[model samples]
Target chain A: MGSGLLVETYVFVLAVFVGFQLISKVPSVLHTPLMSATNAIHGIVLVAALTLAASVRTPGGIWVAAGAVFLATLNVVGGFVVTDRILGMFRSTKRSE
Target chain B: MNTVIQLLYLLTAVFFMLGVMRLRSPATARSGNQLAALGMAIALAATLWANHRFAGGALIALAALLGLVVGSAAALKVRMTAMPQMVALFNGMGGGAAALVAAGDWVARGPGGAAGAIAALFTVLVGSVSFSGSLIAFLKLQEWIQGRPIVYPGQKAVSLLLLLVDLAAGVALAAGNLGQGPTPMGLYSLLALLLGIQVVLPIGGADMPVVISLLNAMTGLAAAASGFLLQNQVLIIAGALVGASGTILTQQMSRAMNRPLSNILFGAFGQLRTEGGQAVEGTVQSATVEDVATLLAYARRVIIVPGYGLAVARAQQEVRQLMDKLLQRNVDVRFAIHPVAGRMPGHMNVLLAEADVPYDRLYEMEVINPEFAQTDVALVIGANDVTNPAARTQPSSPLYGMPILNVDQAAHIVVLKRSMNPGFAGVDNPLYLNPKTQMLFGDAKASLTQLLKALDEV
Candidate 1:
């Protein structure tokens, strides 16, 4: 049986609260990095998208699932890699150290 | 086995949380990103393993390989200057994926019940909107479309009508009365996409960063809806965190601009404020590169104010070199960064960071505003709106009440620009006409290089 809708709603609401608390402390200078980083984290949705790929039976279903998988993978891999590239630039130079 | 899988998903959620938390500072941001990536890997592996009984393994493997190649190539090739557009594109892809997943599930399994139907409807609606809207934002940033807000008469009314239609169709679908085919869901999805385009089209380019953040949040919420349809806990948690954090980031960006969220989303900003043209009373004074070089070389204290122009000119390296040369001459030089200096949040900081400028020399608006008065020379580089005196002096001006860097307070101000034209807000800047300010008109890079050459000779 499903975990019931109420439990999922509870998780969603609590996670929202946690997100708010954690992100509020980020300073303005780190805002871009924060944005890019969060962009990467949300790529976890790929897990949901990929699960649909295996069970799809029809030709149309397979095509759609393939497209979804492609997009989700791009979101995850590109999101994380690009975010890392940007954050790597945040490393201090000799002057700051 | 189910218990172990749940525990692993829970651990992945924890790692995602820790990743976001670690991103609070620049020092730990890289590790934070790595942690999040690791969590994504664990979640993906667990999902594939638990759902192994499903068919089409070969197709899934092929898709994974294709996605990896394309994603890694795009990530590695994108320049830091185009990071905003890259983020918009990647975020949009995630939204598209969520929408597709929901559509796939509905087609294959049918909405199981009222709750399932509602979740599917929401995923389709929000995901389609986020996807289309982010694509528009990416195009705007990429200059494929005009960065200015595009609006026609009755645009707002039409957009509202589309939203209402989408909502009605959603309700119809959720009630299971929209027939067996995907007709109703398809119509609503199309409406949501159009609505997203209409809503974002009227926001000027200058406000794109905030709009991007808002859309990112929408995508996250859409993904959470997909999680609900699939009854997946980790997807829900990850989606919620991204959604909530993106919302806060949007609010913070809007606050930094000193504009209300509603105004940014709906405001057709950046239109020419010709009515406010009377704000500036004096003619601009022009100076040459040698004149600026002489002034800079002799100054005891110099504060550099960088704006979007610096990014456009790709002059951070030259600027850094000048700073180093001046420092070598025993001159006290610092950088004054405005909160909303460039197109994206912290745009200037990242550019300067890339140029290997010392992080210590960069002071935020509040920290450096007061110090401008004591400085001998305040150098303004390709920055217009952030340094505009109209923001402080003219209530009739569009930029009124927006806190600006006090570059005017310095004993002498040298502004580097190609022309006397207004900035992104398309409003007049009286600072250009100020008696204390000298306009050094040229390409920012060429002007800086000339000024640096002269300074070296001096």
Candidate 2:
């Protein structure tokens, strides 16, 4: 069990390094969208919500997990959709105002 | 079969990583977001398939579908000025979800053991903090709550005491594994939530972007702790990626503004520095829209500096109209955008781009600073503190050492402001008092409309 945590720690550390390197290179012009994208990415917690939903037996636990699923879905859906909408406006074409 | 599902999850994680890398440029960013969405679908499918036999299937599906519709509508309908609040709202939901997941895990499984207890408790504490903190941030950004730094006597002391108590409660609940009526778990979560509100309350004004980014990072870390509780590889990876990236980006934003990360967070810049008493000796010159139009009409080159006011007044389109007329008159026109010009980095860019302001015409501070000297007219619109020359010279000024757009260097300066009221930082600007600077007062949009009509007559 301890070894499992150690392995997860290894993965966590390496992922931090990867994220730092990748995001540091993105220009400040896109930092707003970059924040939105990362916000969407962490919505991966939806997986936890789904897994908990299946196993939770208590009525209270099920209700709690249901709420988690709802919020997680919102984070995933709203985050990516808003980010796409913003980035869509960044066209290079010179349109007359 | 389980191993296969884990492998698929890992593969999808690669998609997420690739998606983030694609954000390096605007050209590929839309496709990049699509790829990440694809990854999310795969991950969700893998989990749904894996957990098919688990209970509460009908309820989960209902919640997910309901969330999908509401989330989409909100995203599609929110106006650009409200973008910061929208992001804050979504971020708060993520943090709240992680905390609830952790809380449910503890209640359902009785912490599973020591390792589980630690992970679950950690997620519960941090996630709740991020949840409540982001909500307060949302209210402040939405202007539902006052944007001023809400401080009470001994605010710092209260925050410190609460934090210490929170940690102690977390330790006791974990070590003792106190399984009883109401549970210390609820107390822990409650304290953490209060701690979240305390954390964000004293932060106000131009410091919001950094706060939002930091809260984003906090939520990411909370999500990561939930990953540890669930033993989920993808959650671990994605959460860590967001946590780390959000942190680095926060520091970079502070650096871009030439301020320390700590100062940005704790300095409470607007509250600490009221407008300084030693005022400049020069008289304030007020000009009319006609005077500005004549100045612009005769100018060879003009640089326009935009600020939060432009965003507040929704004047980007009118500003765009002005720019088109200037170009039609054979007067060169460009926009000078300070990095922290709006509530968030790139806010002004998005607003201008929405109004069809060409990206090529928007010059960042570094590129546009030198050109101001050669320009015949510098049009300052709703921008105040960023143009304050004190940042460059005055040692006692709160804005001192923060990089500013050098609109003062232009041969002629016309400022469009509501009044002589100082900018958000409460630091009086010497630039407005300069002999060459003339303030043209009123709402930014109204003045722009008048200026446009005056330009036609000129």
Q: Estimate each model's TM-score.
A: 0.96, 0.96
Predictions: Cα RMSD each: 1.8, 1.8
- For every model in order, what is the number of clashing pairs? 0, 0
lDDT score, residue B340, model 2? 84
Instruction: Judge candidate 1 at residue B364 and give its lDDT.
Output: 88
Itemize residue pairs with steric clashes in candidate 2. Answer: none
Q: Give the alpha carbon lDDT tens digit for every residue of B286-387 in model 1.
A: 998888888898999999999888988989999999998898888899999987777777788888888878666788898999999899999999899889
- Tens-digit lDDT track for model 2 on A1-97? 6899999999999999998999888876687788888899889999999999988987888898999999999999999999999988886644443
Candidate 1: count of backbone clashes, pairs at least 3 residues apart or interchain: 0
lDDT by residue for model 2 (B323-437), tens: 9899899999998988888777677888887787777788888999999999999999888888999989888887788889999999999999998887888878899889999
Give lDDT tens digits, candidate 1, residues A1-97.
Answer: 3558989999999999999999888777777777777777777778887789877878777887888888888888898888788777765555355
RMSD of 1: 1.8
